[model samples]
Target: MPAPRPPTVPVLEVYSTFQGEGLRVGERQVFVRLARCDLRCAFCDTPESYPTPDNARVQRQPFGAKDEALPNPVALDVLLAAVERLDDPPGLHAAVSITGGEPLLHPHAVHALAVGARRLGLRVHVETGGHRPGAVAHVLEVVDEFSPDLKLASATGAPTPWDAHRETYHLLEGRRKALCVKAVVGAATPEAEVEAAAAFAVEHLPSAPLVLQPATPYGDGPAAPSASTLFRLHRAAGRAHPDVRVIPQVHRFLGLR
Candidate 1:
């Protein structure tokens, strides 16, 4: 029989950009943004990812010199190929960032994509909403780094899923692999919420670094929190977590997509 076809998932786009978030910020990475987010964060810049797309936009040449559209439910092979294309002179790129719509939702696809990335001598990073513990456990071994968002009601427009967050952290803690927690705070985000998120990180994954991402203005998303709010939130959260740092969406600053 011919070799089995690769698993497929709804891919939004595949492109290369500098790591724009916590921990590995500034590293060159090919981001595979999948479609279908579960949360409605008021400040989500990529609101387009909340729904499935008709096709996945792929960078067929370095620096996006050429682009192609692969029909939705794209195969794992195509994703790897896009990464390879963007890599240019080879090894110029770093890890393959497997991002939203909540990547953990498609655990099997995440594993397949991560494995393919490893074959190409690249690391695997999965960005999640930090609510799906079962899915996290399933793909934890394949993923090299976990960048999970701690969804706060004050920012994401949904009540905090404390139980799910705790359980997910319980699984990720103490692993040799990297872990970074992120909480998006808006201008009106209460200080108490930030403290709670920081304390939760300290209590569960004390070794994991936490990032306070100020919400950037997009549609219903609040504008960047005032400097006063940012300072107070960081100050309060920093008291509980040793590695807490405030990092806005750096890609925005660079005018990158």
Candidate 2:
């Protein structure tokens, strides 16, 4: 009998870029953006993730519209191949950043990829929305870094599961891995939320960095969050969590992958 095959995992897109956020910001990394999201935040940066074949709750939107569905799913093998083909391959000491659509939603698959990457000596990092701690824990063994977002005032009015996020951060606190808490900034990200998120980070992951990203202008909309808002948030949040820093979506600024 043939050996049982590993389950195939669906990936949205893969590209190479300077890690635009989190503790490992500006590092050359292979970004694997997976293809689904549970939450529908009004200001969701990658609205393209909402309507996978799995997102039955999703309503299809136009290509450049608010919530566009991805037609192709890159399997795990194909994804790995693409990473190896990057321009600065091998010499870059690739850091595999498994982001979302909510990477924790596919923890088993993400963990598998991380394990495989580590075998090749690549560091692994994960960026999640902090919805499921149980799922997050399963990948901790292979994940070298954790960058969980503490969602604040989601555009859809969904509440942040602070308890779950806090629990997961604590799990990574003293571990050998580096950890960071990120909050995506928007016009609606209240000052109170910034203070609270910063305070929570300081109380929980005291040594970990906190990242603030100003929402970028994507799709037909009024505008992205202003620079003033980003500065204000960085200052206030930094007051509580001294390591807090502002990082915009560099891909947008540079107009590249």
For TM-score, the strongest prediction is 1
lDDT of 2: 0.70
lDDT (CA) per prediction: 0.85, 0.70
Q: TM-score for all predictions? A: 0.95, 0.82
On lDDT, the candidate that comes out on top is: 1
| Model 2 quality (TM-score) | 0.82
Superposition-based RMSD of candidate 2 using all C-alpha atoms, in angstroms = 6.1
lDDT, residue 24, model 2: 70
Please report how far candidate 2 places residue 128 from its true position, in Å: 0.8
Which pairs clash inside model 2? none
Per-residue lDDT of candidate 1, residues 148-174 (tens digit): 789889888889999999888888885
Residue 226's lDDT within candidate 1 is 94
Q: Which runs of model 1 end up more than 4 angstroms from their true locations?
A: 1-5
